[model samples]
Target: MEILIMLAILSTVLGGWGGLNQTQMRKVLAYSSIAHMGWTVIIALINPNLMILSLMIYIMTTLTLFMTLNLSSTTKIKSISNLWNKSTPMTMIIFLTLLSLGGLPPLTGFMPKWLILQELIINNNPTMAIVMALSALLSLFFYMRIIYVSSLTMFPTNNNLKHHWFFTQTKTTNMI
Candidate 1:
C-alpha cells in the first residue's frame, strides 16, 4: 500500500508537471492521462467502483478531445488557435471536454474526482486526499491554457483560403 501511494504521488507530479511545457495537444493529453492514472491508483485502493467510473469518464472526455483535434487535422496548440472560424460548435466541445478532463465542477469529469475525494476522506486519508486535490489544480492550469488558446486568442489568418488547410484539399478517385 505504501509503494502504491508513493507511485500515485509520483504519477501525479510527473504528469501534471510534464504537461506544463507541451505545445502539442496530443502530448498534453498524454500527460493528462499520466496524472489521471495517479488519481485512479489511489481511487482503486479506496474504491474500485470509483476507479472504474473515473476511468470511463476520462476515456469519454479524452475521446472527444482527440476527435476535435483529429477532425480539425491539427496537432500544435497554435494550429487550433484559429479553429474558432472553422467550426464554432467544435471549439465549444473542445472547451467543455478540456474542462471536464481537468475535473472542473459541474462537468462530468468532476463526478469521479468528487466521489473519489469523498471516498479518500471517509477512509481517513486526508493527507493523500489533499495531495490529489492540489494535483488536480495543476491539471486544470494546462486545460485552461488550451481553452484560452483555442477559444479566447486568435491568430492572424491569410485571406487567400476560404477553409482550413485540411478541408481545402479535394481528393478525386476515378471509378473503374
Candidate 2:
C-alpha cells in the first residue's frame, strides 16, 4: 500500500511537471495520463479490492479516446482553434473527451467515480470521499475552459494572416 502511494505521488508530480513544461500535444496527453494514473493508484490504496477494475476501466477508456484524438488532425490548442472550420467530427470528439474527463454522466469516466464514491462510503470514510468529490469540481473548471475554447469561439481574424505549414501539407496530401 505504501509503495503504491509513493509511486502515485511520484507519478503525479512527474506527470504534472511534464504536462506543464512541454508544448508538444502528445507529451501533454502523456503527462495527463501519468497524473490520472496517479489518482487511480492513490485511490486503490484506500480501496484495494476494487483498484484493479477501476484502473483497467480508466486506462482503457482514456487510451482509446486519446488514440482517437491522436489520429485526429488537431493535437494542440492552437491547432484545435483552427479546427472549427475543418472537421466537425474532430471537434465533437474533443468536446466529448473533455466532458468524459470531467466525469459527466453516461460516459466511461462516471463509472470510476461512482465506484470510488461507493467504496469511500462503504469504508465509512465520508470525509475522504467528500474531499475527493469536491476536488473533482476543480478539474471540471479546467475541462470546461478547454471546451469553451474549442466549441464556443470564432477564430480570430488576425490568426488568418498566419499561414500554417501543416495545413498546407494536409491539403497537398489530401489532393494526391
Candidate 3:
C-alpha cells in the first residue's frame, strides 16, 4: 500500500511537470496522458471498477483531442497559433476538449476525476487526494497553453499567403 501511494504521488508529479518544456503537441498530450493515468492508478489501488471507468473517459477525450489535432494538421505549438484561421468551429471544439481534459465541470472528463477524488477522501486518504488535486492544477497550466495557442491568438497578417475559402462541412464524417 505504501509503495502504491508513493508511486501514485510520483506519477502525478512527473506528469504535471513533464510537459512544461514540450514544444511538440504530441509530447504534451503524452505527458498529459501520463498524469491522467496516475490518477487512474491511484484509484485502482482501492477500487478497480472506478479505475476502469476513469480510463474509459480518458480514452474517449484523448481520442477526440488527437483526432481533431490530426485533422487540423497541427503538430507543434507554433503551428497551433494559426488554428483559428483554418477552422473556427474545430478550434472551438478543441478548446472545449482541452477544458474537459483539464477536468473542468459540466463535462464528461470531470466525472471520473471527481469520483476518484471522492473515493480517495472516503477511503481516508486525504493527503493523496490533496496531492493529486494540486498536481491537476499544474497539468491545467499546459492544457490552457494549448487552448490559448489554438483559439485565442490571431493569425499573422504580414504573410502574403492567400486564404482558402473552404465551405464549412456541418457533418464531421471523419470523426465517426
Candidate 4:
C-alpha cells in the first residue's frame, strides 16, 4: 500500500512538474488534477469506507476547475500573464478555482481534504497524516505559481516568447 502511494505521488509530481515547466497549461492542470486525485486515493486506501465520497467530490471539483480553465482559453501561465487586465471575470474565476484547488477552508474543495484528515486521525496514523499535510502544501505552491503567472504580471510581448499558443485562440475567437 505504501509503495503504491509513493508511486502515485511520484507520478503526479513528475507529470505536473514536466507539464508546467513546458508551459503547457492544459497539461499542467491535467497533471495537477492527477496529483490531487492521488492524494485522495491515498487517503481512501487507508479508509475504504470514505473512498467513494472523496473520489466523487474530487471529480466534481476537477470538472469545475477544467471548465474555468477552458473558458479562459489559457493552456499555460505564459498565455494568460495579463489575464486580469484582459478579462477580469476569468481572472476572478481562475483565482477562485485555484484557491479551491489548494483546499482553502470554506470552499467546496476543502471538504475532501477535511474528510481525509479526519479519517486519518481516526485511524491513528500520525505519520501518514503528516505526509498528507505536506503533500497538500506542496500542491499549493504550484497552484499559487500558476495564479501568479496569470494575474500578477503582464504578458511579455516579444518574439522571444517560446509559446505561440495564444495566436490560435485569437484566430478562433475572431472567426466567431
Best model per TM-score: 1
lDDT of 1 by residue, 41-140 (tens): 9888878888998898888888888888899887888877677778667777888888899989999999898898899899999998898888888999
The residue pairs in collision within model 1 are none
Worst 10 residues of 1 by lDDT: 167-176
How far is each candidate from the true structure, as Cα RMSD in Å?
A: 6.6, 7.5, 5.5, 8.4
Which has the higher TM-score value, candidate number 1 or candidate number 3? 1
8-109 in candidate 2: lDDT tens per residue?
666756665555445455765676677667668767778766777777776776776677667665567556666756565666777777667657788777
What is the lDDT for 22 in model 2? Answer: 50
lDDT string, candidate 4, 1-176, tens digits: 87877875665465445544546767667767776767666766787767777777777767876787787787767766666555657677777777777777887777877888777789887666676766676666677777776655775455655443334558779889
Query: Residue pairs in steric clash, candidate 3?
Result: none
Model 1: runs farther than 4 Å from truth?
A: 156-176
State the local distance difference test value for candidate 2.
0.65
* TM-score of model number 4: 0.72
Query: In order, how many clashes per candidate?
Result: 0, 0, 0, 1
Those runs of model 4 whose alpha carbons end farther than 4 Å from true positions after fitting are: 5-22, 155-176
- TM-score for each model: 0.86, 0.67, 0.85, 0.72
lDDT of 1: 0.85
Instruction: Return model 3's CA RMSD, one decimal.
Output: 5.5
